[model samples]
Each structure stands twice: as structure tokens, then as C-alpha cells.
Target: MKQALLILGFVLFTLPAFAAAPEKSGKSKAHGNRYQAGFTLESPEEEAEPPEDNGRGVEIPTLVVPVFEDGRLLNYVFVSVRLQVADGVDPWKVRGRTHYVRDAMIRAAHKQSLGADGNGRALDREKAAKVWMATANETLGGESITGIHFLTVDSRS
Candidate 1:
């Protein structure tokens, strides 16, 4: 019984000392179900930068059209453009041409023209909380759109 008691006392005192030793370099074991101690490595910032692209393209303008509660683009409005083709051109061909233009406009407005998806396409409530809409204006013979006129349609927000 004396020998057993001595062995028990030795184990009780030595357990804490053993636990204080430094852990091995690689690999870590989580304690219990909660996270306590471990090494986490993130990729270096220099290596995180995206590779460069060499594609050249035409640039389009972004128009911020506000939606007005009453004759104003303050409450709620979409950032978009209404393109009307030049005169003598058939409306059908104009429609076809404007489709690509509108597509480019949407891409530019959403800032998705770059390699990665831009904030415009993101549903994030912070950065690009503003909405966008595309509408093609009808041309009157040679009549043309003098300039982008941001008009308010409806206001609910």
C-alpha cells in the first residue's frame, strides 16, 4: 500500500511538468471541442495579387439616374443609359447595335468589365447598394438623344 501511494503521488506531481514541455513543430491537436491553441498561416500578400491581363477594349460612360419621389432623382433611382441610334439607320439594326452597347454599359456600370466580378454585380448592401436598369430609346428619323438625361420614374424607397 505504501509503494502504491508513492507512485500515485509521483504521477500527480509530474503530470503538470510534462504538460509544460514545448509542442513539436508540425501538426496540432485541438483540445476538447473548443479551439484553444494552434498555428494558422495565411498566404503572403505579394503572392495574393492577381496576374495582369493584356486585353484592350473601348471604355463606356456610367450614368447615375436617380429615381424621384416627385420630379427628383433623390429617393430611389437606377444608374443606367438609354441609347438611340443615328438617323437613316433601320430601327432593327439600331436595336441590334444597341444590344451590344447596352450589354457593355451594364458590364461597365456593374464594374464587371475587369477580370474579377465587380461590386456592381454583388448584392452587398454596402458598396453597390444602387440598382441599374437598361432601356433603348426610339429614334425619330434622324432625331437623336442630345445627352443622357437622368430622369426619375418612380419612388418607393
Candidate 2:
């Protein structure tokens, strides 16, 4: 049992050395770009039953947030995102989804970021809408954006 434990300890220590060893291939497939982040878009799920709407706008399903940011109230920052088309989705459709996802993400993030405030929900709605419209008009049309840029706005008095 003592010998087995010693062998296990030796193996554990040596395993990291194997991970740190240099690759044999001179030409690396891995490029050294720190700015890039991985993103995945999952295909839309098949609905068993279609959503029902009573004439106004479609009801956005409420997502239950389990965590909230712990901090003092700071200046509200609005992010103006500009998106460029890459793969499957077209420019116009991508623009629309960008708008939708931007709204969804902002609402979701704000709920977490501003949960402590009494007026958090109200402020997020008003500010997010303004930012979304401004970004859509100014950044979406005319010039084609190659990617996304988020500009922040301070709403603290």
C-alpha cells in the first residue's frame, strides 16, 4: 500500500511536466492571437407547440437569474454594439438578430449587475432601448461593420 501511494504521487508530479513539453511540429496550427474569443451559435430548437401572442409584441420568455453582482451602484454604462455578417445569416437578418440578442443579453446582464438597486429594472429598460435604437440607426446602416464594437454611456448623476 505504501509503495502504491508513492508511485501515485510520482505519477501525479510527472504528469504536469508532460503537459509543459514543447510540441514536435515546427509549423504550429495555433496562431498567437489574444484578442479572439470563441463563439458558438446553436441551431434553433423545434417547438412542440407554437407560441401564442395576443396582438401586441411577442412575449419574451423570462430567464431565471441565479447570481447577482455584489458592488456599490456605479454609473450606468450603455454598450452600443455594431455587428458584421460572417457565415449563415445575411446582413439584414444578422442585423435583426444582433438587435434581438443585444436586447436579450443587456437585459439579462443588467438584471445581474443592478439587482441591488430599487429602480434597477426601470433604468435597464429605458437605457437599453435608447442604446439599442441609437446603435441600430448609427452603426447598422450605410457602412458594413466587420465585427462588433460596444460604446459605453455613463448615466450617473
Candidate 3:
């Protein structure tokens, strides 16, 4: 009977501690109330603005160059290039001089011997981009071009 009374007293004392609701503190109320009220904690001035869209740049047509090995044609390399222009440069100006650019690119490709060589070594893309940039800059009358990106380079034997 004494043990039963002791157990009942322990249950009665501990039940209130577990059942009581938590007190809403000031810090938690400030943070949670703002979110609940649909207001963001971070101010709009703290957010970064997106960059401006200048243009899509220019895309050159695909180029085909034949590979030679010891006086015989071995394979052909097909390359598509995109010339990325800097901001404020007009894409129409580059488009207007497409013929000269194409000619310059063809000459550059031929000079570089693009594609597999007689020793079966493949052309380097970095070297090709550098050459293309140089050629395009020379043809376009200035260094308005930011980069020369190779969209596709496929070789067939």
C-alpha cells in the first residue's frame, strides 16, 4: 500500500512538467511571427539584382576540312563555331562581314592542317580556338570577340 501511494505521488508530480505548454520567448516570437505574417526576414535591398541581357552573340556555320596523310586524303573534320562577342558590340556588324570571316576561318583551318595528321595525331582544340580568335579578330577589324567556342568537332575516317 505504501509503494502504491509513492508511485501515485511520483506520477502526479511529473505529469504537470511534461504536460505544460512551452513559453513563447521574445527571439523565437520575432523570427517566427515575421515568417508567419508572410514577411521575409532579409530586406529587398540585401538581394542582388540580375545581370542585363546584351545579346545572344553570333553563330558561324559548320566548316568541313579534309585531312591528308602522305599526299592522300585520310579523313574529314566537321567543326561548328560560335563567336561570343563582348557587351555593347553589335552582332549585326559581325553578321554583315560573314563572307570575310568565313574566308579567314577557312584559310586558318587549312594553314593549321586541322584534323588527323599523317602520324594519326588529332588536332588540338585549344590551338584551333586560339588560331580562330586571331583570324577572326584580324578579319573583323578589331578584338571585339570575347571567345571562340567550338560547338561541335567531328572527324570521320
Candidate 4:
């Protein structure tokens, strides 16, 4: 009975020490400063803006260019082009001129030599992209396109 009373007294005395709230330390303030010290907390209402359509761009239909070698037909290359317009530019304005844009792209593709040594072998993608960019800018009467992305280029030989 005396040992039980001692144990009960020891537990009662130690329990209050464990239950007490921890004191703030200088190290805690230093650690907190290392992360997000100068940052202001934003309310939920301030972060509720709608997502912007940054990647909403226009895609042109596939273009087929015929490759020939010495009066003989070789194969055709199918190319898909996408144009990303600059800010404040109306995408529909470019879309409405699809016919002219397609014509310009076709003309540009035809000018590129497919083969390594002009033997009508493969698609000249780099040259085609350059020419297409130039032609599209000329057709649009201004530099409205921010970038030209080639989505696909397939050759059937």
C-alpha cells in the first residue's frame, strides 16, 4: 500500500509537466524565417480567378506534298501545322482566312526539296517550317502568330 501511494504521487506530479504547452524558442523563429517569412497570406477570394486559356491555339489541316525525281513520282508527305497567336489577336480572324493560309503553306511546302541531295527522298521539315512562317505572316499582313508548332509529319513512300 505504501509503494502504490508513492507511484500514484509520482505519476500525478509528472503528468502536469508533460501536459504543459511548449515554450516558443529563438530557433523556431529563425527556422520560420527561412521559409515564407516575407510572404503574405492570400485569402480564398483573391485566388478564385478563372483559369486562362493560354494554350488555346489554331491547328491547320494536314497538307500533302508530292515528291518527284527525274520525271517519276516518288511519294507524298503529310504535314500538320499549328499556329499560336499573340495576345490580343483574334484567332477567328486567322481561322476565317484558312483558304489563303492553306494555299500559302502548300506553296511553301512545294518549294522545299525533300531528298538529302534533291533526289525527292524525305520531307524537309526545317525548310518547310521557315517558309510556312514567312508565307503565313505575309498572308496575315502582320506578325500575328507567336509560334509555329508542327504537330505531325508523316511520309508514305
Whole-model lDDT values for every prediction: 0.35, 0.42, 0.68, 0.69
Per-residue lDDT of candidate 1, residues 1-157 (tens digit): 9999999999999999999976776456645466334322223342233223222111124433222223323222233233333444454555445545555444443442211124222122212212222222332223332223222112122
| Per-candidate RMSD, Å | 21.5, 17.4, 23.7, 22.5
Badly placed stretches (over 4 Å) of model 4 are 1-56, 68-73, 114-120
- Candidate 2 wrongly placed segments (more than 4 Å): 1-72, 114-147, 151-157
Q: How far off is residue 37 in model 3, in Å?
A: 68
TM per prediction: 0.24, 0.29, 0.57, 0.56
Q: Put down candidate 2 lDDT per residue, 95-132, tens digits, no spaces.
A: 44554555555555555563324644223434444443
lDDT of 4 at 24: 59
Please write out the lDDT profile of model 3 over residues 1-157, one tens digit for every residue. 9999999999999999988856656454433433222211223343233233346467788777665655566556677777877667788889888778878888887765655333343445666778888888888877778887666666654
For candidate 3, the 10 contiguous residues with the lowest summed lDDT are 35-44
| Candidate 1, run of 10 with poorest lDDT | 51-60
Instruction: Report how far off residue 121 is in candidate 4 (Å).
Output: 2.6
Q: Which stretches of candidate 3 lie over 4 Å from their true place?
A: 1-56, 69-72, 116-121
What is the C-alpha lDDT profile of model 4 across 1-157, one tens digit per residue?
Answer: 9999999999999999988846556454333434222322223353243234466467889888776666566667776778777777798898898788888878766665543346365666566667778888888878877677666656666
* Candidate 2 clashing pairs, residues 3+ apart or interchain: none
The better-scoring model by lDDT among 1 and 2 is 2
Q: In model 3, how large is the Cα lDDT of residue 156? A: 53
